[model samples]
Structures are given as C-alpha cells and as structure tokens.
Target: MPELALKKETGLKKETRSEELLQLVVFQLGEEEFGLDIMQVQEIIRIPEITRIPHSPDYVKGVINLRGKIITVINLDTRFGMEQKVHDDNSRIIVAEVDENVVGMVVDSVSEVLRLPLSTVEPVPEIISTKINANYLKGVGKLEDRMLILLDITKVIMEDAPSKVAYC
Candidate 1:
C-alpha cells in the first residue's frame, strides 16, 4: 500500500509548492529594516516634490500628484519618533493601500521583494524598540542574518498622525 501525502495547509492534494509562501516588500528606515505584506503595496517610486499640509504634524510630509491623482505622503522617520532626514537619491515613496485608502510612505530606500515560507513569520515579541508602537507591528519575520519588522499598515498610516487625515 502507498501512503498519501498532504500539504501542511489547505487539505487539498499538493499540486505545486508556490502557494505556501508569503511575499513581502522590504524597505529601510534609519538603520532598521522593515517589511509589509506585498498585497498592500501598490508601487514604489523616487521621492517627489511634496506640498506641505498646513497645521499638519511634521511626520505628515504632505501630498503629491501621481498620474493626476493627489495622494497623501508621510515621513516614516518622524512617524517612528526618529529625527527627520533630508531626502536623498536613495529615498523613495512606497504607495500602498491601507483600510481602503491610498497612501505614500517615505523610506530611506526600497529593498528587494522577499518570499519565504509562511512559518518563518513569528508573532510580535514582548520587547521591541520604543520608537514604534508595538500595535503597529504585524510580526517579526525571521531571516538568515536579520529580522524584518513587519508592519501593520493600517495602524501605521491611520494611528500615528496628528489626526485621521481627511483626504477624499
């Protein structure tokens, strides 16, 4: 008699190994690295000229017109309680969807797209740096030499602000 094999998730017979992986768009802030679920990322682009929003917190970098649509952008540095750094050639804006809204977040640089087994992601640990709100972290992704701080996009975008932005 032959033994039947099954995939770890989804009781269906295994066809290919591709569906069992998690994808992430990795980026950097100051000296730390972070990641977001790839599905939340729309696109990444070079930092553009941003128009200041009056009375808004310093973290709110402002807005930009991307292909004729105005999108609000924020500074990840300030949002994480770090000193704001001037935009350089390596800086970029990662456009993403959070809670049904579009937002562009500035990062030191956009790194590579990482794909790994879903099991490699672990729940948020008890202690982390004080700069970012732990509620904003999805989990800590374990990699070979480093750990990727996975972000909860909705919280990062909606909670860490002067107030809920009223962009239409």
Candidate 2:
C-alpha cells in the first residue's frame, strides 16, 4: 500500500539522519581535551624550530617554515589563560585551515581521532566553567565516560582580529 511504502521511506530517512557522524581530531591543551572538525585539520607534526616574532602577542608562539610555507603557530594554553606547560616529546603542532589562512596550534598532545554521532553533541552550557572563552566553543560532546569540548577554530584564531590589527 502507498501508506506502508511512505512509512518505510520516512523511517529510513530518520535512521540515516540520526546516524550521521561528526569526525573530530581531538587534542589536549593543559588539562582539558578539545576537538576540532577533522575536515579543518591539514596535518599534525612534531614541534620544529620556530622563529619568534618580536612584540607579538604572548599567545603567539611564533612562525614555522613548513615545506617552504610560513605558518604562524599559537600556544593554546596561553591563549586560554592557563598556566604554561613545558613541551615534551608528546607535544605536537596541529596544522589547520582557519579563515582561509593556514595556521598551527601547539597542544600538549594529539589524542585519538573521534567519530561522534550528532545526537551526542550538546550546545554550550550556560554555566560551563572553562578558561577558554565560550565564543570559541562549538559545543560539548558527551561520551560514555568523558566529554570533549568542541572548538570553533575560526573563532579561536580570529577572536582579537578587530582590535589587533597586527594579527590581520
């Protein structure tokens, strides 16, 4: 019957929509775990020699030459107003595209790539207590035993652009 066929189609659509997944490249900054959309990330590399720019913001770690391309690096800990930690062997640079610019972020370590269903992601909480500004968060991803702070990379990179002309 037409009604039965229509019901089956609608059920299939709902099932597919509910199963949609968001892939993220998770990384650690200080004591918190953060997730960035995998599509935005270019690559992950070990820390290299960075050329410090004079008089730059404290969050700017410097710049690095990546295969003949100059990429600016940001220290997430300092940017989030967290205590700075020494980089060790686990330290890594996450190269990502933000607002048409290729930039790198220094994180304590790179964690596993996560694939979370859309149903698990919740909007930013009103009382969420995080050192990082709420404007930089996309949402909070809830897992069985843990949670991930999803980051809006564009906001993270351009938060001060209006006031900081040097960063533009």
Candidate 3:
C-alpha cells in the first residue's frame, strides 16, 4: 500500500512538471525555424494585399487590414537582414501582440504548434553566430532532431521606439 501511494505521488509530480512546458507557434523564416510564445499570437492568416507606407523603415512591409483593424506588418527576413524572398502560397502572417500593440509578422511558412519543456530551452551560446540580432532572441530550444530559435517578439517589434507603427 505504501509503494502504491509513492507511485501515485511520483506520477502527480511528473504531471506538475510537464505543466511548465512552453507552448510556441513555430514558423519558418527562410531556412531557419523560429518560435514565438503562443500566448502572444492572436491568429495566423494567409497573406493578403498590403498597403505600403511611404518613408517607412525598410523592415516594415506595410499594413494590412484585418477585419477593419489596420495591423502593421513586418517582414522578418528584412528585419533579420536575410535575403528577401517572394511570398508564396505557404507564406503566412502571424498576428501577435507586442508591447500592447498588435502587429502582423510575415514569415515564409508556419510549421506547427509545439510544446517544449522549459528544461529544453538554453540561453544563447556565446560561440553561436547568426544573422539575427542577439537582443531579439529569447533562447534556443533543443529538440530531438533540430533546434528552434525562440524570438523575443517584444524586442523585435519595439526595438525602434521612434519608428513604432501607429495603428488606427
């Protein structure tokens, strides 16, 4: 009876630990995979015609009207200094809330919703090199086959205060 109680207690602890997992919306940007906290993502939609804003920052792709809400769109490729690629059928806009502002991030494609244990995430290694600015990275998530670059969406969207997109 004591051994049975111990097993039950161990199972409960395991369940509690699993609850610490980070749920992410994973997407592809060029050849690399990136993830954003799922809580920040409002929705994912197919790419729509975007209205360009003249004199906007180079990284700003422009704005899209999402059900009467004008959401500013940022091209992650341009923002990360990667070669821009033409949008295709797989291209998607991830609508996420950052710094109290809702914005759309254009990605090559959205892969899947992944739940990774917090223990699997590691701080950015000093030896690792990448095109993305370190300040925009939260951490690197290790998976069985590949690693996922976890982006700090707040830093990516709000880095330039003066150039912050104003939504109506």
Query: Against the true structure, whose lDDT is highest?
Result: 3
Arrange candidates by lDDT, descending. Answer: 3, 2, 1
TM-score-superior candidate, 1 or 3: 3
For model 3, residues 112-164, the per-residue Cα lDDT tens digits are 99899998899999788888899999999999999999999998988866255
Candidate 3, superposed: residue stretches over 4 Å from native: 1-9, 12-19
Per-prediction TM-score to the true structure, in the order listed: 0.84, 0.87, 0.90
lDDT of candidate model 2 versus the reference? 0.89
Model 1 has a clash total of: 0
lDDT (Cα, tens digit) per residue for candidate 1, span 1-168: 123333334344353465577789999998889998999999999988889888777677889999998988988898889878778999999999888788999999988999857788898878655678888898888899999988998888888452445372
Per-candidate RMSD, Å: 3.8, 3.4, 2.2
Q: Rank the candidates by TM-score, best first.
A: 3, 2, 1
Q: Is candidate 1 or candidate 2 better by lDDT?
A: 2
Q: Is candidate 1 or candidate 2 better by TM-score?
A: 2
lDDT of each: 0.83, 0.89, 0.91
Model 1 misplaced regions, further than 4 Å: 1-19, 160-163, 166-168
Task: State the lDDT of candidate 2 residue by residue for 1-168, as single tens digits.
Answer: 999999999999999877989999999987788999999999999999999888778888988999999888999999899999999999999999887788899999998998999899999999967778999999999999999999998898887872331242
Model 2 weakest lDDT span, ten residues long: 159-168
